[model samples]
Target: MTAETQAAPVVSYGRLVPVVVHFDDLDALGLLHNARYPVMVERAWTALWHERGFGFDGDWEAAGDFCNAVKELRIGYEAPVNRPGAYAVHLWLERLGNTGLTYGFRFCSADGAMTYAHGTRVLVRLDAATLRPTPWSEPFRAVGRELLRRAS
Candidate 1:
């Protein structure tokens, strides 16, 4: 893909999900709690899939009663949000593997001034009932590949 078609951090990542920080999300230090980062990441990913019409908010049956389980996660902290207000989480497909997908993301200021945190997560598709790792469906793989291509 040409630079023009490459995913822009502000627009073409898998999804740009807004996060309205709540008072409850803050710790006594006046920053978002360390644990909250993962939660936000998870929420953003879920929203991405939902927006693509393949998750809980969409045709669940078409998803084949499968769920994604995190196989690995790594995060790096940058600055902290001292004020509670609007922020955003950027999600994009980093890598696609048989039975798994790796997503890269960042928590940034609403205007892209600062990146508060960044991370990558490896998710394995699993049969909800069996809880056994399963290969992703063609549609899912295609979606991941497309995101990767756009992000390239």
Candidate 2:
């Protein structure tokens, strides 16, 4: 992809989802701390699940289905988000494997001048009971594949 075409934080033909910020996410500097990046990712993952109609409540441990492990996480920060307001987060699927998924994220500032952060994450699916790596079920594979098709 050319730099011009790949510039967006979330570049998918599908809808660009938004994730609002929380007051408690701030650090002493008033901007969101670096540690909160992963937390936002988890939320984005959950939001994606809901958007796809795959029900995953906060009760993953009790439901016997979950994103059990993260294989990789990388982020780059370009600006500080210290203001108190809702921010937009974009997510897209790069690779959807049988037992795992890779995601790309772009965090846009409220003012939309700079991209505060961008990242890619790989996660492994696991059996809720065994807590071990396992291939995705048919429904999951299908849903994930459909989602990836919308990627720009």
TM-scores, each model vs. reference = 0.81, 0.75
List ranges where model 1 is wrong by over 4 Å: 1-14, 57-66, 149-152
Q: Write down the RMSD of all candidates, one decimal each.
A: 6.1, 6.8
Q: Can you write out model 1's per-residue Cα lDDT over 6-121, one digit (the tens) per residue?
A: 33356655556776677899999899998998898777667677666666634444455247778899999999877777777877788888888888888887655589999998
Error of 1 at 28 (Å): 0.6
Positional deviation of residue 84's Cα in model 1 after best superposition, in angstroms: 1.1
Q: Could you tell me how far off, in angstroms, the CA of residue 61 lies in candidate 2 after the best superposition? A: 7.5
**Model 1, global lDDT:** 0.75
Per-residue lDDT of 17-70 in model 2, one digit per residue for the tens?
455667888888798989887787677667767666666667756443364688
Give me the runs in candidate 2 sitting further than 4 Å from their true place: 1-11, 57-67, 110-113, 149-152
Error of 1 at 98 (Å): 1.6
Candidate 1 clashing pairs? none
In Å, residue 34's CA in model 1 sits off its true spot by: 0.7
